[model samples]
Target: MSNLFEGSTFCIHTFGCQMNKHDSERVAGMLEGLGALPVDTIEEADIVAFMTCCVREAADTRLYGQVASMKNISVREGSPFNKRLIAVGGCIGQRDGAKLTDELPHLDVVFGTHNLGSLPALLTAAAQEGGHRVEVLDAADDFSSSLPTDRENAWAAWLPITVGCNNFCTYCIVPYVRGREKSRTLEDIAQEAQGYVDAGVKEITLLGQNVNSYGRDLYGEPRFAEVLDAVDATGIERLRFATSHPKDLTDEVIARFGTLRSLMPALHLPVQSGSNRILKAMNRRYTREHYLDLVKKLRAVVPDIALSTDIIVGFPGETEEDFLETYRLVEEVGYNQVFTFIYSKREGTPAASMEDDTPREVIQERFDRLVDLVQRKAFEANQDEQGSVVPVLVEGTSKRDTSILAGRSPKNQTVHAPLPAGVEIDELIGTTVSVKVDEARTWYLSGTVVNEDA
Candidate 1:
């Protein structure tokens, strides 16, 4: 096929989870493959695409506001194209479809989570035909991993072992927008991981809505442990997965924490709420006690594992007692990090129509208390890392201080260190180096370089 987008400059704005980020990378790769150059900002590009999220009402508002603002941006005087093309894809496009162009009349192309590969064609049609071209597929025709990728970091990659979700949590729109669970074949995933490793990638984070349920749809049973084993054999240095549902977290997968050599010692198991009544209402399929037991089992195997979680402050019919339960659970978990959110009613979710009598002030107050507790717990967790030497996979120079290098430890803690004497920041961007802890803050650690050769 001819490169239809030859010489055009494009930029993509992405929102939401790692899955969406990976999707954007694939979109960038596709555009680049069609002979388009990537620009850092929308104003500089002939095409501006948005990979959107509709998980929270806030995300919808943000997407609408940003897309609306682009109506004022005009094509550069000497640009390669006659006009700027605006495209929207991912969750919001999947949900709203043709309605999006109606809402944002300037939108030219509307793709979706399932039809990301259709973006170039749609954009071409819109450009030549001069009308809105929207194609929102109801199901995925292929695994997106098979598509080319333009990873932001050459040393790191997001590999999706599964796409979509089956668990219809009352408060979540993910299952509805993303469709049912569809696991990629284990062989395909292993081969992809091997490819990343062969290409000098240092880290691979397995992506899925609920990673614990991986391979269930394809193999008729959850084989996530085997997936880990397969990826671990690929010789990747750092491995991780996200958004594990507590109910589906099996003993076999938990054992991998102690056994897998390449698996990082960090987990993002989201316990959305700690009240059993609220959990039941959310259709999470696990009680607070069951979640606590799972945590206990995880700690027993990997005692020093860094734990992070997501929590919702308020839901329908939540009372002070329910809120207390959540507060107490946070205290007990003592997580290294907590992503707390005040409940935002997504329109299609069941919770949206439920009785939410909790006042906005009450929810905000609860959120504030949770944030304070989370910060304290995080500070305490970092304090434990003080005086220890850790190997950090360097990301880049710290944004707050240029002379300092910033990276993540195996537990995913942000560890910063001064540049080695005579060493340039670029030299250490993707290399692993040892840092001896000198200070521990609430969210990150600072240290001196202990092993420059690592």
Candidate 2:
């Protein structure tokens, strides 16, 4: 009970992207190394650390509010919850280390991107001497160290093949905050994938800021295909990666996907905009035709591949015609889903310094129109699956009703079906089950489980 790690339990509250989520895994791995058991609820935790993010202003505000609320929870208890050592970390800590520590003195330990390996030692120090904030943002460490993690689930897991980003996209903050692209060695990544395969991980989403740009620092060129081949060699049932740069998605990589059966029928290729002017403004190296070409390549290999994209509607000087150009591309491609947003300017990005021509109301209107187009396309796309039987890896029970079960198809469509009679949750997981599409919503699909084993 003296050291926080030696205490009863610990919980990690993570924010931001997949990279941050992977960082939380390393944080958990560190705590477990120091003899800490993961707690499901903060109420039961003797130590709680917030793996924070500061990309969105809202992420920072939400983290502070969560920590402050936890403090109130501790105070309201029969005994002071000061015994529960609270901590804050990630980009927020990297960006505002001393200021954050001075502001929230209740936090036990605060660490930045570079201090993951030193976390256990820091936690030990914080427990004895009280609250401490240890941030080393500018100092990006090179050594790749391993840590302990209490995985969130079994069948599905996020396997980080790389860390950080180098691309200084005009409107992005990741490169500055997370530092240059640092890839974990191929052997390390493959070993991690093997571990998941051994543990019965059926579906693995290989994560990174720009997945296609993986291994450029190590193998000389972007070796994402090599990484994929290595992971696939481990005999993992399913494989996927995301947030690809159109420029880095070479012919070899797209061709590899065609041959790799495990690589599913879904790809999250984020084409920020369809206008050549807007694309150049955002510092995306690929042109509008290039993105369409990449989609065509992916479609040629996997015809049923579901397409999803990220589009910022009113990026700085976006004109109405530019917005219409984006809409026209959406209509032409008919993506299964489109993530549309009115761009939020980060203070340091190149685009932020540019003159803002698009009005706020206009941005909102354009965003709404983009969303409307996506909804109509999604409905039309699902209409084709009306009577088809599809195979899905049953994830678990449905959220709406436990009487039903949930899973995902090769295209990564969320499907729910009645709980198969006499089927246990353990048996249902990690196994391919056939389901008939009974109905389709804007997002998820309703299905009925078939076969006794399914």
Candidate 3:
């Protein structure tokens, strides 16, 4: 890597999941190593990069709109760099490749999920040739976790034990764009986690497309439980994982919730739909009964665990009965949070070609009903915590009011507390404090700081 980007100001606009966010962080770290300074906004940047997502149609629209809008903006007038360069990477870049440069003629560099390390070279080439330089590799040459990172939080980190997805759910584009599952060696994962602990990180979220399926490709069977034990052994204060598939979630992993010291009492097991028919059509590999049973076992082991899920309401050919089954499941689960989505057809996905006679308005109605149920269920779940004391890992002050310091509880619930009289906000940013809940809203809990040293 040359110092071609030396003294340049860069800003990265990230749009997507934790994996994409982590990728952007690595890119930032790489640029900074080449002497580029980070700026808050694109207008101030001599180099603008977009870490994009193609999971939903809305993400595609937003990325295109933002990239197009940059055409009229220029680099900061007083900056040393003479011209601004725009680059796009992540899922969309992998999916679209050189087509992006054709669509957005101003694009200078286009790298993909598999070739993040090539971005700087591509940028250098673009600067020399004054033309687009695109590199989209079909397979990953290295695990991204091995890359340098400029994490957003000094005290928290996203640790990827695996990358990509093997399960091709009918509605998802993840497996297509991210490619097949690739698990990093367990020894490598633990070493990185210990490094984070040594660097004073308080939290680590193990990231993967389907976390419960980690190590299956490399080890010949899922060893996610062993991965959890290794990370927990690093003595990090908190540990979490995301985007679990119901089919791959085993009893061994569930058992860790009751035993692991650093594992948080929270899980995000995405059950896309509740109808067995729709589940089969979506190729989820788990029936409604099996999913409910898993939930039961999870609760039996860790009763106070905060459960959250992703639900897609309007899948192709979803009937009224199917929606009702989903409604009933939501009522039964009483999740702490629900990420609801109306299905959007992706060009290469199997569900995109499925027949559907249902009217748009009918789907909209089902979506609205699901949203209503989800909100009520979330509110009820919060209400259950009204008088309980929670230890919150302070993130920062709330955006709406600086007087209120905000953080997350063990269950990953947002908790707000007034800043104590003598304590500065920065002092509490990375520390855990005991909060006594006074009120519970639909989205968060209001509390007072009861113990700062907690």
Query: Candidate 2 — worst ten consecutive residues by lDDT sum?
Result: 73-82
**What TM-score would candidate 2 get against the native?**
0.93
- Tens-digit per-residue lDDT, 1-454, candidate 2: 3344454577888898776777788778777767677878888777788888766668878988888777665522532234677777788877777777677777777777767776777777776677564756575555323656656666767887666777788988777777777888889889988898999888788988888988888889888998888988988888988778888898888888788768887888888899999999988988999899888888898787898888887788889899888999999888888887678777777978989866788889888888989999988887768878889888888877887888888877888888778877678776888998889877778888776454
| RMSD vs true structure, all candidates | 1.2, 2.4, 1.2
Clashing pairs in 1: none
lDDT computed for candidate 2: 0.79
lDDT of 3 at 182: 94
Question: Per-residue lDDT tens digits of candidate 3, residues 1-454?
Answer: 4567778889999998999999999999888988889999988898889999999999999999999998898668876555688999999999999999999999999999999989888888887678899999999978887777899999999998888898899999998889999999999999999999999999999999999999888889999999999999999999999878999999999999999999999999899899999999999999999999999999999997889999998899999999999999999999999999999999999999999989999999999999999999999989988988899999999999998999999999999999999889999999999999999999999989895455
Backbone Cα, N, C clashes tallied per candidate: 0, 2, 0
What are the Cα lDDT values of the candidates? Answer: 0.92, 0.79, 0.92
Greater-TM-score candidate between 2 and 3: 3
Model 2 misplacement above 4 A: 1-4, 75-81, 139-145, 452-454
What is model 3's C-alpha RMSD? 1.2
lDDT of 1 by residue, 29-130 (tens): 999998889999988898899999998888899999999998899896666556789999999999999999999998899998998888878888887778
Query: lDDT of model 2 at residue 121?
Result: 70
